[model samples]
Target: MAYYKTNKDGDGCCSHSDGKEHSNEHIYEVHGHDKNEHYGESCGGSGTCRCEDTHKEDGVRHNGANASSKCGCGTGHGRSACGCGCEENFGSLKQTAFQFGTAAVFFILGILFAFIFYDIKLFNFLNLKLSSVFFLASWTAAGYKVLFTSFKNILRGKIFDENFLMSIATIGAFCLGEWSEGAAVMLFYNLGELVQNSAVEKSRKSIIGLMDLRPEFARIYNPEDLNGEKLINPESVKIGTLICIKPGEKIPLDGIITEGSADLDTSSMTGESLPRAVKPGDEVLAGFVNLTGVIIVKTERDVQNTAAAKMLRLIENAQNRKAKVERFITAFAKVYTPIVTAAAVLISVIPPILNSLIFSAPLNGFESFSPWISRGLVFLVISCPCAFVISVPLGYFGGIGGAAKKGILIKGADYVDALSKAGAVVLDKTGTLTNGVLSVQKIIPSKGASDTGMITAEQKEVLTYVLVAEAHSGHPIANAIRKYASENLSGTEYEEFKKADIQNYSEIAGKGISGLYKGKPLFAGTESFVSDNLNGGISRSENSLSGTRVYAAFDGKYLGCIVLSDTVKTDSEDAVKELQALGVKRIEMLTGDNEVSAKEIAEKLKIRYSANLLPHEKVERFETISSEIKAENKNNTVIFAGDGINDAPVLARADAGIAMGGVGSDAAIEAADVVLMNDNPVLIAEAVKLSRFTRKIVWENIGLAFFIKIGFLGLGAFGIADMWGAVFADVGVALLAVFNSLRAAKCRKA
Candidate 1:
């Protein structure tokens, strides 16, 4: 797969659109070995359009054959059935102005004024038809449709669910001679739905905000035609298509660079602040915007089939797969709705029938049937749990929304729940506990060596040759050496760059490489390779511990050594202190670095234990801890956090593998359970606190809802609570639930 910036002659659009129906004349190649062999793919140019054919053959890389662009819709430029070519933008529902509620509020206030002017109270409104107009006005503005649907369903012999509950309760209030109360119920009920809408939109704002990282459309060039005709909607784009990207535009696809150069602000995707300079054959994600200069990209991965895209889609569907304690409410509704309907039926007719019960209790019981029916009406009015039902899920939605605002994308509700259960945390130290930047801190030169501690002319040449070779291999030490030299290199800020052409350039399978250096055959790699392959006798006894060794051999002779060590994060000690302060017991650091370096880091962080480990060694350490926790029945959980190429093994092995600051490694992101978007050491503590906060909110909402319901239900059953009191118990508790859940969103960075 590849992303490219191949421009069709965009200098003039007027001359290109003559309805000429040019065939296989505009599509030109962007990058790769063959241009004529690449097939016609989707047109990615904007306003006007151009088409190229690129095929996904065998559903794998480079296996694809070319094919013509086809829009599902049959219209001209914007003809896709998805209406994708059309000028439509997806916008989330707005919660800024609550319209559904504004209509209901104004309507309620209007009717309340009318009823006051008429001097009609609930008891007197029984015969007062003028006040019915006010009730009607309020009902229509708020819940009138729900009321009608409930009745319509009943005539069809089925209860209408939550709608039925609302209708029955409100009608019962009016029948009991409480017009104002009934109007209030419907008004507030709509307000509750508005809250529901707002809560969902909150999640929408959060979920969609992540997608904001992607561009609205793509610009594509025609491959067949020679004219510079570029098109947009940019649909029909497949992997390996080269599309020109202008400055400040979102990258349309995930691909490698093939032409031009520019600085890329990838912080939105990778969370790194520095603007990365991009040239041809470098991988670009879907969302990152190009910061400076013009860039032409050759797409390497398909637009639809990227890891970033998959992660984005996973977040959208997460809520549907799992939920919080509210799952019980949804399940209960299936049974609760029908049962509540049955209770309403019983309340309405049973009272009038029970007026003659036994003919002994209260004299003239038949004459007193109206009061019995009034009390039954109160029973129906008080039992509606409509408020509780809507707000619970709204809370969870709000929590997730809040998390996304900070760039932390949780993949599922279950992860949220699991986060709340976090009691103990384990972390991989290389990337998570430390900065993962291994540098050359010191150099030990051979006897009678130069001041920079490098030994001979042979040594410096060997060092440069070896450093440059492994620099091609991409180790942390290699990057450090490359960066240090580039910074110290006697040139302007970032010098003119070019790829070096070489002879006898060969790579040792798992080790290093041998190539021509400065017009001489040179070798740079591991000590074993230099010693055995060249069969050269060398002195290595001068170099010492605490760093990774990088050796050099120039003109078939050995040079002295340079050592690399992983640097500790500057605030790691403080981040660890905060964790320890939070009652996080047994904080430890696990690293693949050698024992000396690991011990030094652990000592600096004041950790109780330290493990200098390989991938399997870390796994063994975690297993022992897990068993110890279980044997002692400590009820403690062990979690591992890591962000490294090698930490994948330990990350998956731990209870909860948190991939912290995963900027570069694709494999680490896929392996971990949780990904901390920002590379903050303090976030480990914050995430623990967030999990605890979510749990606290969940329990608080549950306790509030249940306690209020139980208390009011008991009082209402014994006639100690009136219909108004019952309303407070049901709706009041629900409102409290929503307010309580909002706390999860309110958690702070501290």
Candidate 2:
């Protein structure tokens, strides 16, 4: 196995291969190369690139001119290459348009026949019978699917849907001898169905358009011959494999640029409208299109595991999770349908019987009941519960998609509901609210020490000892110390001093490092690490700085301390105010930093603060805060945000766990319910705003649907409305609610 690097011209890129055959391997295979390049000795054919094979388990693709392969994936979506298995025969916009056109012609012809031919008799059929035939023809033309679906659902014992209700009400009109009314009701209902169906399809197209951001092919090249490029399926791309991305191609997977530069269009993933300029060593996510230049990227993840795929999975899975409002609607519809059917029957029978008996009139069997039965048909049509049942979940779906467009990935509908109710938001200090990079703010000299300049000779020696002890460490604090020492010290003296040998270097967890420099012990760490080791060389009284204090000592004598600080993020204060404005009752910062620094930051942000807590103690404090908030107001919920492995516990335990996905640990990301992909603290407030807006839209749909349906029910029962009017009230209201749900997609603030 070997690792090869690519030049700026996108040549000579390769990765490790074990020289064993796998079914689906990366595109880089060992082959004969030029004498100067070092890919391998010869083209042995022992290692094969999986792209040459045409038959994969899911589908087969052929490269030859006459080769044909059957593809049933994404057949009707007009995106056959993406391999999504969406059904093609589910009816298209063209089909809907044709249906509407034909129905309108038939409806107008039936109207002419009913009005003009009522007195003309043909053969044994009366004028009314001829007109009835014309209206029935129009009904069949417009409501064919509704009629067939009703019959099928009846056979399947699923008899409580809108299809069944519509079928029953219109057919009941014919039974009551209102032929024109029956045909008009079915025709108008189908027209509304067409409109609602088209809106829903348009919404699905918006989401599917986002899913199409994945690239179809990856351009791979051999290390020995960069000119020999191969097109391979993105699914076959492996981690750590080098792939070349040309301009106008979508990035196939999550990766880092190995060479070259590009301007990326990230609107599909982050809704950022601007093209971002990226250079080598910068990480790029999937679903962004490369707008300019050809860059070589080394894959960090497989196609299915990239950020784009994860966001899609989250959205698809959000539908399966029921929000509280959705569940309430489901339960309400289930019980309301059967109760209304019984009420329709009672409305037909009881009022007519009581009217004839109480008024002492002659009750004719057929004629006396006909009027009441017509009113019952109107009741049944108004009883259809499709409006509320469909729109509430659709609203949540739109909300989730809108959040992902902003780079906030919410895992489920329950989380959307939780975010709307968020009250107490607890934050981890290091990375959640602060920049998390340690840099020296100031240098402090011991009291009564005369200056050999502000940095005394003793101080320079102590810095040199600290630098030597921290030389091999890769921690941020250590890097800050090393960088300071390199920049401030005289260059010639610093280069010469770097040659001094040190031994027994070791880093103590949560403390610092120690080593032997020139046969004398050197130490640098927290106040406790330096004090206990140095034994009163510099008293603790002189080291009471507000920032992170690192003391240095050599051979049991303390020189001075360096004050390093992790600055609060630029967005932190505004984000806190936004959270408060979004109705978060309390905000708190939790940290392992000392009390003085914690208090200072909390005061500046004007939020509650807890200090000097260990990882487990942080969780305990969060629990106490949560209980107190709940005790005061039971509706309040606690949300925890963090970006470290130690934060996984609290993230999982909180009502809503938000992980900063950009720099978060794998454990924290996996445990979190919501992931802020850009690591912006302000997105928490934005997410809350989006959730609240979605819930508001959902409630509006619910109230509107209920108000319209109930008003129609009363009017139909009192005989003020007929079946035709009921049809309009039912389907028209449903179409309006569906259109209203689309507002969630347009919500820009969240």
Q: Which candidate is the best by lDDT?
A: 2
Worst window of 10 by summed lDDT in candidate 2: 34-43
On a 0 to 100 scale, what is the lDDT of residue 334 in model 1?
70
Instruction: Mark the regions of model 2 whose C-alpha exceeds 4 Å error after superposition.
Output: 1-104, 116-131, 208-212, 221-224, 291-293, 442-538, 541-544, 549-562, 661-668, 748-750
lDDT (0 to 1) per candidate:
0.58, 0.73
lDDT score, residue 597, model 2? 82
For 104-128, candidate 2 gives per-residue lDDT tens digits of: 7777777787787553444464335
Which digits, one per residue and each the tens of the lDDT, describe model 1 over residues 1-750?
Answer: 122322243222212223222222222222222212122223333212232333223211110111332211111232112222111111111221343455466655656566556544454534765556566567666776677778898888777466777777777667666776677767766665555555555455555555455344566654566367564433357766778788988887777777778998876665557888777767778788888887777766664555455555545555554554677767776786666556645654565566446554554543555455444545555556565566655556556656655555555555666555555567677667777777775444444245654344544444455555654656666677666556544444223221344467787543557877667766655556666645556575643466655666666666655667777787677778877777766677776555566777778788845554556777888788767765654556677788876778777776567777653467667776667765677767766666666656666776776677667655654557776676576666666676666666655632
- TM values, all candidates: 0.68, 0.78
What RMSD does model 2 have? 8.9
TM-score of 1: 0.68
